[model samples]
Target: MRGPHNIIRLIRTGATLERTGAMKVILDAYEAPRLLRMVVRGVVWPFQWLGMKGDTSMPPATRALTALGPAYIKFGQVLSTRPDVVGDELAVQLRVLQDKLPPFPIDVAKDSVRDALDVQVRDVFDEFSEPVAAASIAQVHKARLKETGEEVAVKVLRPGIEKAFQRDVDAFYFAADVIEFLSPASRRLRPRDVIAHFEGVVKGELDLRLESASASEFAANTVGDEGFRLPDVKWAYSGRRVMTMGWAEGVPLGDNDALDAAGHDRTRLGERVLQLFLSHALRDGFFHADMHQGNLKVAANGDIIAYDFGIMGYIDEYTRRVYAEILFGFIQRDYKRVAEVHFEAGYVPADRDVDEFARALRAVGEPIFGMDASHISMGRLLSYLFEVTERFGMETRTELILLQRTMVVVEGVARSLSPQLNIWDVAHPIVEDYIKTSIGPRAVLRDLAKTAAVMARFGPRLPGLVEAALIRQSEIEAPHNRGGHRKMWALMFLGGLVAGSGAVALAVVL
Candidate 1:
């Protein structure tokens, strides 16, 4: 899959990292190939010795990644959460990579807004001020909309950051390709697919309109949800480069002094934060992945207002139901149910022993009993669970990793507010309620109704579907007897069987 140009580019990028001193990040023993890594370090050793290249002031691991640009900055953010791979010290330093960057010139910000909305600076905002915050991709400015005189925050992407990000993403793909080509050990991690996912997550942020839609969708999903809110996105003013949203006024979640002065109860607030995250993930199947203290604020009314929707996560309905049951099972101390959920989801291999998996889960769940928010370390639990998963041949679950990372960060945020907060007490009611609504008798009837609706629409087309398949099969067999026709006929037969079964089931149920 890789060509010579890719190999040349990788060497050049490696040189860039070496010069930046970011290459010094010590990796885990399992991260191969040792010869290649050693060759890189050896190649860069002279540069370090002569002090002729690279800035060594920062940690060796973070310096090079910081030099790479936004995509790699995101990689640093992820690495910060994976202490087992990068080591604790390096992970701590990598925290700075979480959207910490200098703001681009204010003139550039104005130009971006003007171009995106096709309006003059004064035409839209009555009072555009300096950027209050800046990150790897964009900077935020507080302004008053000219039409309504309403305060809103405007986010503008940096002028040339897009090109830099694209180049870095190409570099990532090149690296992934080389790894897959050279190292069999890395295939388990699925490096290329992982980079492809990273590509999506990073590039998605470039379009502010998409972010607005996501925020709107998230808000809709959390409608009637207590203690949390999302700012209304002003589509009229929002565009690819710029987004306008109602200004959220609140104390940062991490600001204890301000939180106390504002007459907010940290203990209760902490419980609300954790509850909101869990409910969004399991009940709604969507959530704000970047829940750092900076993105979360406690409003004067004690409502939590979330901002910065560029980075979001989602799961399907099936996964959502499974996640809910797993949490509920943990609450009920039913380890078998937790294990069953994993097996049913195919996260664990079917060949694995369910009882052994249950026992392993029990070991993880039992230790956290009676633990408060501070005492219950979700990260440690996940780490132990990961260890157990490896024994059972569980593959790397990329989607769930984002959820796990966010949960760990959120629990830390919650614990900071209420050291003695009983997470189990807060989570139990929510999980139990969701499971009840989504499982058992109510769930079966709901599923049947959905199935009937699907059949109602699809049943009429069954004959045509089969007929088309048969025609395709005949054409294929007449031309090329390459045995490809079997699939076409097999698909046709399956379609007919499904159509018949669905009609029969619907009639019997009615």
Candidate 2:
């Protein structure tokens, strides 16, 4: 009953499993010997044609995925984030899958809005034109708010995207579950869990409401900050299927000519954008995770307006502190502190010697510090840090990965605008200010005052705490407890009995 494509995909999957050393386990877990045979037959020739003679060549995986279509492209993109699962070299290659889809048809865009919004084109917007840019899930249009005569950008969901994405996601879940069952190394990476997380992220991306909320929250976070802003959401026109935002009139940050014609200073704008993002990350603990040139615009006054808030990043107070400390340590060439912070945050394995790890970190840092400002790249620096962390068995953090990806894109855009832009110089002052306000005596006083007020409110509970402790001591001393030793012995005996029974059961049943 299998189609040619399905048969080919089966072969591709087996080839992947074989190369990754999961072939037998995959066969055992999936219980699909017949399919495995078919897979090997279907994939062998295409792979040979592609010059991937051995099981180890990931170009086979890449070619096979591309052959399988959109679903595989999405899978490749997901795998790109999981350097731990796919290995660094393969992950790097898979990064090509990001936003590689051709744009959908223009008619489909118009019909999608009409069907979703239940209105004709003229009724909704004064002028709804063609798609400006097309991406994986949707394409954007330039339009105007009908009543207000205000220009707006309308994002229309690709029709049947949910169904298409759902099919691929279901397939991904199948693959993840099978991989986790078959490979212990993959289980440590939690393949199923990673797929689930990807599912949630992509699902959230599909829901226009969540994206709007992300925009609203980010807008609020940057309200007081200067030189950077987000497009105001036109809530009345926004929904699950569509997002309408204030029409921004500005040149794309990557277009040097347009930026110059608009009277914007590329160097200054680039510096502001870099500082703004770092400030949001280090100081506010939240930031827009998708800041590529297409999603960003520069107004005549040089304010950078960030759009496409479907993806964002957040770190808690503790993560914030650790992240800042790591940056501060790297800046000062204090690899010891950086290593200690990794240990303290439980990022590096405790058994690893801190001095050894610090030495590894020094290798990543020393080169950056030695390089001229123009020669240094925050992207490359982060990439090296990831490489070092991987040596220590640190799995990628999604938020941090997203932050790094966004940084790479933003930095690239910035450099394109002004080739001489110095990211380190642009970021240093913001990082310094954030460190001062966050960890200094002034912050300590503010936190202590807040803590004192909470303690004053809980003052009456001190007597209750004493009474509870006295009652616990009385109960512990009671005779039936066997001095609290009987409970421990009983639990240990019960656990042993259960283990013994499990062993007997496994032996007898198998």
TM-score of each: 0.86, 0.77
lDDT of 1 by residue, 1-510 (tens): 435655555666577666665564543433667776776666555544332233466666566666555666787776665544445567668765645677888898999898899999899889999989988888999999999999999999889877877777777787777667766776766667667766777678888889989999998998899888888999999998899999999899999999999999999999898889888888888988888798999999999989999878888888778878777787788999889989998989999899999999998889887565568765566666777887898875656767777887788788889888777787777778778878877877778778778888988888888888778777767746546566766777799788877776687579
Q: Please, what are the lDDT tens digits per residue for candidate 2 over residues 98-176?
A: 4545677777777777776778777978887777877667779999878989988888777788887776666667666
Q: Which ranges in model 1 have alpha carbons more than 4 Å from their true place?
A: 1-24, 48-59, 78-98, 178-184, 370-373, 463-510
After superposition of all CA atoms, the RMSD between model 1 and the true structure is 4.3
The lDDT of each candidate is 0.78, 0.72
- Give Cα distance to truth, residue 118, candidate 2, Å: 5.6
**Candidate 1 positional error at 280, Å:** 0.6
| Candidate 2 TM-score versus the reference | 0.77
Cα error, candidate 2, residue 270 (Å): 2.4
RMSD of each: 4.3, 11.2
